[model samples]
Target: MNNLNYGIIGNCQSAALISEKGSIDWCCLPIFDSASVFAKLLDDKKGGSLSFKLTDDYRISQEYLWQTNILSTTYDNGVDAFQVIDFMPRYQQKDGSYYTPPDIIRFIRLLKGKPQFSIQYDPRLEYGSSKVFTTIEEEYIYSQTKDGKYDSLFLYSDLNYEDIVNQKTITLTSNAYLLVSYHEKLSQQSIDRCYLKFQRTKTYWMDWSEKTTSYPIYQNEIIRSALTLKVLSYEKSGAVLAAATTSLPETIGEVRNWDYRFCWIRDASMVIKVIADLGHPLSARKFLQFVIDTIPDKDEKIQIMYGINGERDLTESFLDHLDGYKNSKPVRIGNAAYIQKQNDIYGILMEVIYRQFVEFETTLENREELWTIIKGITKIVEEH
Candidate 1:
């Protein structure tokens, strides 16, 4: 049985699910709403995954690094031991902007003796409907659909490329790194650069966690939940996702499944309220900006949800090629609830806006904008 015993690693731009055994079973690159590059969680056969196959005697365990989104999976067999550290690059740049690319780094470091494993780098582009062809180059391994919407991925690794592609068992003598990216990197690529990125990302997460309000009781739980909420927020648009995945049935072999990758206005506003109370006003401010940007015109009918990038018209559809999670069938993407007229959304949105006005000080112009939005919401509420 396929269980949800997976660790999530994301850069706020996109996220991936790593199994307890160190396999990237589900991931969508570049952004949360993009077509999946790895979807083995949905279909074990046609869906693809990047995994490390170890011997039977090895013991495996998965856990997130303390105070960071970095996930570490360690494998041990008494004589040999190693850890695969997985994370997506997310950090601040020199100009105060962020450097969050659509990339996942897997750092394999040897802990003791010589640990041997095989790499399975299978990527099914376009929901496994497109025919993908993988080619090797000196700097990176490229996988793309031979025919279709021009989807591709680049994998830069310090390990042997041939062995990785051939799935041959190799002994780990020292540290190795694999960088999977949605776009081609312009800068020079090396193991040292990979390690630097890992450190920077670790620092970013730690700093973010430190900024959250901690309680005397359940401090760890609060920080952990805050980190999870932070990861689900879209950095570019400040839209909070209800969930990252789509089409996992509520019950096995049932059709009660829907896509949840989009941002619901009511849901995001409520989350912002909690986050603001936790001393993270930055997220709340960003979400307010998202609300403003989404409803530029006061007459525009607000949707229940919108794309992370503020895209409307989120027409839902199904991918027939891939099997549903656990044979539930009817894998779906996008969402169809945007057309629904949920009157209570304005109330939730107004609550957050009201909190922002009372809790934080802002510029006169910004305050005026909020006041105007408040009037707009009041008018809409009266109309409904």
Candidate 2:
């Protein structure tokens, strides 16, 4: 029987899929909100992925490390064995601010006997809708797109790809190891700088994971979910997406294709409650602050289903050229809801403010200005 297993490693902004045989099936980078670079999970041929597999038969099993987003998958080929570790570093508190790359890392280690493996690293640009240019440096494989609109990916692996047209194979003896990394577009110097950053990033994640408070049951799963939620949050704007992928059907071949690249007010409020219940009150407060900073006029006439860094303009459009997931039609980007009128925003905003004051012990320092705006909104509501 061929035993196959899978696990997930996420930075809370984005996530990756690691198979038991040491393959990375999916990953999106820079931020959870960014377009996918490796999207083979949606389309095997067109969508790209990073894959590592053995030439011979192997049995596989996978699981996440305790209370962390780190994942481990083991491959046993009768007498031989090996494992792959995958993780995305978490944000760190250094110099009173968080620092870490929005990248994914995978490490493969040999355990017992010799094993031959083939490594395939393919990256598609712009949600698998564009071609990518691949470059091979001394220790890294760089894949970049033309327009420079999306995040580039850097792969660091021992497997050489001098002639990428031809598939390459490598042999690993017991105790041997290989590391692969992904990052955004960077110059040669910038790539060189990442080596040091790799060490720092690993330490940062390990340290942060150490700080998490323990739970009695389902601790690992809960922490992974929490981290996933956290990564989906826009630290600068406090907006959170429902998910990373845009066209993944809630039901295959259905019209459930909705773009999740921007912040949703509904999801943000729900996240506030989730984070608060998880004992991360600061995160909830930050989201509230983001909401307050985002609303400019407070007139209640300027509300939307979603926005980008508080920008009221999100012009929705469709991409007719590229086929949708599972052949689902009409792949669309952006949101046109900003143009619509939602009378409920005024009451929702008032309720949010009230909830913040009561649950978070928040008091608006500019109460006079806030009340003046409230009076205007009340007048509008009364008149309507």
Candidate 3:
């Protein structure tokens, strides 16, 4: 579960890393910046995970849907087999706005044989510290943290939960979909709406792929990299995260892991260039505006990075409760490099300004205001 065998899925609002072994090993609930609700990627025992797996022996294989970010994972043994199609629903709708929801869709189908499946629905909240209370109603298993921002979680499915409280396998005779969702707002979506959203999401990703300019021969690789950037871009803030995950040691037994969840001006300057070039100038536009808005009034030190919400004080700290990934010590979070004296931040940001003003040739609504801020940044960079 701790290898590159996992696939990343997100709706820009939140993201999860699911192991091909049928476990949702890493997920930052509610939002990408929030503490993980299921963090088995960091701490196997203390970090929580939810798994929907076939009960018997099985071999697993996984791949993303052609030209899209939707992941399809298949598990089969000689005796029986099944396939679980996993995705986070994200798409543009009639209003030209996205329908990205914080939900994990597991579309399970009995592929070749009668593969009895089991579910382990253990969720650790508040980074596995707060007490979680779970309740079952009809076909839903809902869990709520004591005082966390995540009010409650709902798992809506078509499977029978008559004897599910104690963790057991239920034989499957038909296909079904399981949705592990966040917040009460999405919980109100009917089972019919859930199915409809799934179809729409599949079409949405495919449509996006179809729209992308196909390359010569590396078409698949190009689409994948482009789609990954799209997933990491937070639509709400116009800020793109470095990565969806945090605290997985780069080198085993070395404390080199760092949280890459925030938007770095240095990073976004280039990220916006690709996103804009690929026909999504809205993100580049938004990120450029965000960078301008975040510039201080010639007094405060312009940080190298900021939270998606524009928070400045990113104090680094270490969590001691759980074992690190592969026992890599001193699992850390809240990158302290924001205070670094890296001059590249200024250079990269200037590159973005060049694209926005020169390459795009688009009229800026706040041209004077933005120019003043740019001049201010120049002054600071010159002196410091």
The candidate that achieves the highest TM-score relative to the unseen native structure: 1
Q: Which 10 consecutive residues of model 3 have the lowest summed lDDT?
A: 183-192
When sorted by TM-score, best at the front, the candidate numbers are 1, 3, 2
Error of 1 at 197 (Å): 0.8
lDDT of 2 by residue, 1-384 (tens): 022235666655566766555567666666655567776655667777777656557887787655556677787888777776676655566577665456665556678887666667688877776668888767567777876464566765444456332456666663333334445334442323443444555565556555556689987767677766765666666676666555655666676676766666655666667666676766666666666666546565545456546766778777565566667756666767667766666675565555656666555563444455567668878988
Model 1: residues with Cα > 4 Å off, grouped in runs: none
Cα lDDT of model 3 by residue, 1-384, tens digit: 346677888887888898878689888877888877798988888888888645447788888878777788888887677778788998887899988878898888778777876788888877776678888875488788876455567777777654354577777677777788775553454557766877888888778777777668987888898888888988787888998887877788888889898988888778888777777766777887676667646565777899887879889888788688888877677899888876777777777776777766545664655677678778887887
lDDT of 3 at 163: 39
Q: Which residue pairs in model 2 clash with each other?
A: 12-231, 12-232, 13-231
For candidate 2, the per-residue lDDT at 7 reads: 62
Clashes of 3: 0
Off by over 4 Å in 2: 1-8, 17-25, 146-151, 161-166, 174-221, 300-304, 337-352, 358-384
| TM-scores for every candidate against the unseen true structure | 0.97, 0.78, 0.92
Find the 10 residues in a row with the least total lDDT in model 2: 184-193
Q: Per-residue lDDT for 153-179 in model 1, tens only?
A: 999998999999999999999999999
Residue 304 lDDT, candidate 3, scale 0-100: 80
Is candidate 2 or 3 superior in lDDT?
A: 3
